[model samples]
Target: MRQTSYFHTVIIGAGAAGMMCAARTGQGGKSVALLDHAVKIGEKIRISGGGRCNFTNRNLNGHDGSPYYVSQQPRFVRYALSRYTAQDFMHLLDKYGIAYHEKHKGQMFCDDSAQAVVEMLQNECRLGSVTWYTGCTVESLTALPIAPAGYEQARFGINTDQGLFYCRNLVIATGGLAVPAVGASPFGYEVAKQFGHHIIPPEAALVPLRFEKWAEQGFDTLSGIALPVRISTGSGKQAVVFDEDLLFRHKGLSGPAVLQISSYWQPGRHIMVNLVPDTDLAEVLCRDKVGKKIQLKTALKQLCPVLPERLIDFWLGREPFQAVAGQKWADIPNALLQQLGQSLNHWTVLPTGSDGHKKAEVTRGGVDVKEINPKTMQSKQCEGLYFIGEVMDVTGWLGGYNFQWAWASAVCAAEALRADEHI
Candidate 1:
């Protein structure tokens, strides 16, 4: 590229992690520069949580960790999260006087707007005096030979219209390819590849799913239906059961349950849904014999009125698979009835596909976390290179887990880098 330039640290992506890192590093008396290709900063933050921005969750249970991440190295996120918890995030929110309320299942959201959260982060960066450039892009990166201090004097001499600015440290907090309109690009993954880091193959997540039209006419009719469900995928190796509203859309399914479970789901695999979750299917049926003997369609319709009658008719069949579809619950062969029970208890239906990146809430599979230090978000292999937020492989469940990861990783890296006087 052009003649290499220089700086103490350069952070890419003006999202939460980058902002946090910049603010912290700057506070430590280090000169930090932040950049973003987008015209606006924190686009994801602005639109998250239905615009209210569910900033963090109280559901960060120490007893359970993996629920928040699926990584090539599963342990990668544990260290970062341990160092910085959701409560720390709330402190920052409080510092800004950003009023938030605890909603369902411990999710905390701003009562006003997501913009408030973004502005608070921006204000933090400003207070730290971290410089920033918007509507900018990186042309390329290459490493230099290791310097005398054991840590190499590596340089990322990025080419931008503003000028060629090189940095001893480079942090990628560009986030994932969830919403391209917000300037979420594959640039982060490409940078990781440039540094010889492996990628976990990214895909759109936390989005609605669309079923094939021909076989799903009945399902399509339930455009406004919603219900609680426990969905499973990957045959069983990966599954999530969430009791939340699953709203029907013209395309497919959406809402909390589907969004939470979608992270674990893969293509071409059956997604098992528990219509009446937890309770034994036989017990539920036996609870009312007369109800059991009712038409299979009628029973399913009764079980979940939110579901369309036509869908029940299609699944229960006019003969319950082997017999007539509308056979009485008692007339339904015991063996076949068992199959229906199995279908309800462990209903398996593979989705045609999910909504792509354009509508995805978050991205699954990003920069492999193994290449980075969990404690500080720094690259173990490449000095001065840190990967944080959704740019790394650490993802979270539907709630505010991902944002929590961002704040945690950023704080960790910023603190660590600030501690380093070498810069």
Candidate 2:
């Protein structure tokens, strides 16, 4: 092997966390190298939010913890998020004169393009004089001996296609397996395993839900239809609900509501979708059925004015509605009307599977949170070893919560590395 060149910190992955950590660590007067296997850097950010990049959210609830973010140890992220809030990143954006606007639910997106956000992060690294190693794959990683008795921790020797490099601190910000086309890999999880860290089995989050039954039921014909809904998955404490737009796709369901619940949804479990959450269909139908001469289908339109006409027709053609077909609103039995209302309000279905990593906006599970320091993001078992961003078990809601976690965790780890003199 060639002689190993040394640095203060070597971060594997040139994505959000790695780049941000490199900038912070290097700016703090430590030598930093940010490396990635992809030829292009920040492809994830480049394609996020339809190219606008929802960089961060204003609703992080940073004073406590981000309520939208999830982890096995839910409170583990509190410290990092509190230390570096979404407002902190907004200030950074202001410094660069990057114009952004808030969309629904506090999702902030760039007015221009996601490329600008990537460039801004790149410029931040430039200011810190951080080195870049794109298009290079790390062949192997080895834990070196502690530097005599004076050093605080042992260093890491990383073998790469380009050459051998060593660092006092090794940060795995390699992200998760989502968007594999952009060169995502299991390298980070493998590194965690090499050092005795447990990896939580990863699943696709923030992706479309597919169902074979729905496709055969002609629900696929409702593609392009979207309406606000209240969606819930799981039961008891594990249950999660989101009030957002639900979209009908050719295969199954996609949209904010489905994406939000997808993280908590397990295989063989059913999801509850309320087509008309804001209105009590039972109450409306019961009150109006007493004297109305209109048909049941017409009354349904009045009850759910936002629902598409085709979807209303489809629902009217099924089950109880089919039995009461051609009947006037007043002629239909009150019991059947109640049943129809209940069905509309509590529609439940099983998802065969998700769109998987290729279509997943984020990976739900990763390096187990229990194995990392909540404050410093350092491995509990390995000194000078850190995991950040999606590589860790932390997953945020569909909005900008994930990006906020990336920023907060990167800053936390960077600060920890800077405090270590040997690192």
Best by lDDT: 2
Candidate 2 — which residues are off by over 4 angstroms?
1-3, 146-154
lDDT of 2 by residue, 1-423 (tens): 564566789999989998899999999999898989999999999999999999998887577764677778788889999899989999999999999999988999999999988998999999888988899989999897655243334478889997888788999999998999998999999999999989889888999999978867989989999999999988888788899999999999999999999988989999999999988888788887877888888888888998889889889888868977678899988788888888889999999999999999999889999989989999999988999999999999988989999999999999998999674
lDDT of each: 0.77, 0.89
Candidate 1 off by > 4 Å: 1-6, 61-64, 145-154, 214-216, 235-240, 278-287, 290-340
Measured on C-alpha atoms, candidate 1 has an lDDT of 0.77
lDDT of 1 by residue, 1-423 (tens): 443345578898999789988988888888888998888888889999989998888876443455567666777777777777778888888888989999988898999999998888888888888888898867766665543243344366677866777677888889999989888899899989988899989988888877787234566656676667676666445545667777767777888877777777777777777766755555555445454567756665666665556556556543346354666765655566566667767866667888889999889998877778778888877887888899888778877888888888998998888877666
In candidate 1 the C-alpha lDDT for residue 368 amounts to: 78
Candidate 2 lDDT: 0.89
lDDT, candidate 1, at 200: 89
Task: Provide the TM-score for each candidate, comma-separated.
Answer: 0.87, 0.96
